[model samples]
Target: MKYAPELKRSATIALWLILLTFPIMVIQVNTIENIVVWRWMNIAGVGTVAFVLSFLWQIYQHRKTESPLPVSAHLPAFQRLLADPKLYRPMLIFIAAFALVFPFTASHYQINIMSTALIYIMLGLGLNIEVGLAGLLDLGYVAFYAVGAYSYALLNYHFGLGFWTLLPAGALLAAFFGILVGFPVLRLRGDYLAIVTLAFAEILRLVLENWNALSFGPSGISNIPRPGLFGIELTLEQSAVYMYFLLIALCLLTIFVIYRLQHSRIGRAWVALREDELACQAMGIDKTRAKLTAFALGATWAGMAGVLFAAKTTFINPASFTFMESAMILAIVVLGGMGSIVGVIIAALAIILLPEYLRVLGDYRMLLFGAALIGMMVFRPRGLITPSSRTYVFQPSEHQERT
Candidate 1:
């Protein structure tokens, strides 16, 4: 049976409902600060109560009505687009503009927040390559990040190497590490793979903390040099706002690389490997090579981000490369949609920037954040921007009929 086409005049109100229910509730939670005097525990307590009440009310309404809240109200194609941007052009411009002017804010706090956001954006895109494009569940992503940051920091500290010289080297080293990681995990799947990756990240963190001779042993390498641009050494005098442009350029370059790779021959092979490894191998696709390449490429991107991060922070500690960091990066990728670069970028922004910006709400922030994440996942499991059930329809092969 054919699915009914959406009516011409109807609108897609599903998203609006979600935004209204969760985001507006967040606004309310922020608004009612006086209702909770203790602040920290108060907000959490209040939000929890409110959520329970709302949930109970929902149950009550459903029991009484014997129906869902609302039906689908789809708009015509042109009208549907009017609510959203025209694919990625607007998003690209949105990203460029935000990255460009965000640095110019008079507030140092904003600049600091945005710098973190840019780093996460890079991290999200890198993880998107592995988990999103290749369908690999990696929990040890921090190892590559650690590898890159440490490689750059140690190289510069020991050899007086410049940031530019060490960035590529760090990426190459991370890629090497990625190959090492992939070899043993070829047979692991799902939760098992995630556990192994998590173990790897923890191991890297422990090594960094314990290896005093090489890693400086938890004291961490401090006073790291920032990247110099065009022979001009970036100093405190350069202003945090100005340095942001360098980050913007780096992000744009990362975006370009991802775009090229997504449309490349290797990208196609990775997608094939993602869909089904046995089938990919049967089709003469070297599944091993494809998986390895995906890992390497993903690691390379994270490594580069780590190099930039080392330069940006000018200090590193074992604490920064913890498993939580890996989980946060993975959360942005998964919450944003695995294969969608734009979704990852948006998720990165929301995850990093939104929490900081919402700090004005004070104690209620994390409570609202947890609620928002849960609501987002419940409403759109695929991600914030990614479509659900977009199938890759391949025509029947000559050997398929016989099989």
Candidate 2:
């Protein structure tokens, strides 16, 4: 006897759920004490909920059909206003004004959090070039960020160089390293490329962790200098505000550069490469150059962000550049709609602020966050803010109309 399709699907979903949740629930680590804690109850609760939801969702989808009704055009006044093209400029002006005055009205903690969110926004924009435009699956993008941070850290620690002087230097060095990594993997794509990048990041982490003479091992570099305006050193509150403004500038610069590039010939090539590498190559687009260019440009942004991160934190460590960091940045890009600057800003804000707001959830914060991410992927796989292309209209000639 054969099982029903729904039953088979439910069983498969339940099996996968068990496999994914078992390790995290069954094996827990206490980093401070180096001990393990087991929580079977949590596992059981999560697994049961996941299985039930998956089964119900599958059934609903299977039974669902498309509606025959036409879409409604008579939206609410607020929704209509938002949809109007004429209102875009005014809306943007209002948003900019709000952002400009936010720090003045908000608490110090909120200001600091927004600053952190801006850094991730910068990172998301950088990765958008590689993964979003060029279709490169980079799991080790944080390695470039690590390079940027370490470059500044080493320069400050040894040579006593200031943040301003090292800013471009860090970006240039990271771009150079990007080319070095890109050259070897120019021909690879998809999972193979992802695996290589992941390995590259892990190698960098291990080297930093073990190289005590160079990186100071796990203890990391300390007392990194912050950016000073003119000759005066900024206080802690002043520094936070300063960083916020600096990040806004950097984010704006990123937006301008990406916008210009998106309309340029190189940008078109990148899009073609993303859509179909084989077809792009057949059309005389050099795959090697495009891939390397994307890598270099993307790395440049990550490097700049690293410099700012070092200045803000006044410390650098191997642990700061981890796989989880890469994943977070990737999620920002995906959730924001890849290649969209405005979407990236919104996604970055949500990713950074949502957790802070949900702090009351305690241990359940991560669980809820995971569930939300899953829901987003299921409902809006493309992204929350998909980019739309511009439209052009032309009038027919009088002669053609008469004919």
Candidate 3:
């Protein structure tokens, strides 16, 4: 009796969902054959799923309202597993071993996919610095990515620079562009900042598209050589293996550097700025320097990743650095959990690899993917893994205690 209202609401939700999806889910027309197929079972399925989901949602809301503990107390099972060093240390070791052996075991196609995922992990971590730590919204991060790719492509085409020479060159050039972006939007925040960054990316793309002589226009630069192994020529398969290992090393280096930065003074300043600009300014932290550094550091990773991307694909064009690329990278950071290294890595892999694996489902793959994203947002709005607060334990020296 007490649950009557809840049940009634769930029933109403179920019916509404069924009504909304009737045309799409319950009926399919064959254009070639002019035949209409009725899938009445889809109606029943929708109703059942909607009702159960709505009921569960109500129960969850009820418990949430009644609970006194903080949201962090209700950590997900995966997070709990990670929190236990006894379990996670072994898990990390096992993962590292598997990663080292994966290239040898997997097919070249699979290796390529994994390499792409690794690139996104780098991008996600870089953006984590800007959006997650510094609370800056950059919608045109791909601009720096494009800058790095073009830097390598153009310099190589004109001056015949090698990948080894261009790797650092691209990163430095991207960092320079990051500072350029930071300067213009020094005072902007929120949506305004997003708009400016997005505009910057679009402008760059447009220039590359129109500048036929400089960028080769829409035809794009091709036949770009792969990363050379100390002037030792290798077969295509061997090069793929070499590239995979290189990316792995770079990913490790990125993780180590960013982890250290996260605990440094500038990192703290970024976090403070993220929390409150006025308070951050009042605390004597240089807001301009913090913002610029965040942008510069974030773009550095993107630039490196861009060089890797160009070397791996052996092609370059403006179409490749669209707004969608930025959005997907941003999704990796946000969905993984802002300011969390492990979360970004996991989310990048899942976001990039999940769709490829889901191809078996054909047309329904994206539908299921969208549903999963919706469920994730509804349940874990904070992200798959929220950044844990830092805790410091205090200890007193024996002499101080005696005094």
Instruction: Name the best candidate (by TM-score).
Output: 3
TM-score, model 1 to reference? 0.77
Q: Name the 10 consecutive residues with the lowest summed lDDT in model 2.
A: 67-76
Query: Alpha-carbon error at 329 in model 3, in Å?
Result: 1.2
Candidate 2 ranges with C-alpha deviation above 4 Å? 1-83, 389-403
Q: Please, what are the lDDT tens digits per residue for candidate 1 over residues 31-92?
A: 55655222344344445555554555455555547754343332224224434666656756
Instruction: Rate residue 149 of model 2 by lDDT.
Output: 94
For 1-403, candidate 2 gives per-residue lDDT tens digits of 3337767777777777877888877889999999998877776676677778877887667645433334443232433555677987798899899989998888889998898899998899999999888889899999999999999999889998989999999999999989988998987879899889888888998999999999999899989988888987788888888889999999999999998987788888998898899999999998999999999999999999999998888888899999999988899889877777777887899898898888899998987888888887786687767665545688899998999
Model number with the top lDDT: 3
Per residue, candidate 3 scores C-alpha lDDT tens digits across 179-203 of 9999989999899999999999999
* Candidate 3, lDDT over the whole model: 0.93
Better of 1 and 2 by lDDT: 2
**Candidate 1 vs candidate 3: which has greater lDDT?**
3
What TM-score, computed on C-alpha atoms, does each candidate reach? 0.77, 0.82, 0.88
Whole-model lDDT values for every prediction? 0.78, 0.86, 0.93
Candidates ranked, most accurate by TM-score first:
3, 2, 1
Which 10 successive residues of model 1 have the least lDDT summed?
Answer: 1-10
Candidate 3 has its poorest 10 consecutive residues by lDDT at 68-77
Look at candidate 1 and tell me the lDDT of residue 292.
87
Q: Please report the TM-score between candidate 2 and the true structure.
A: 0.82
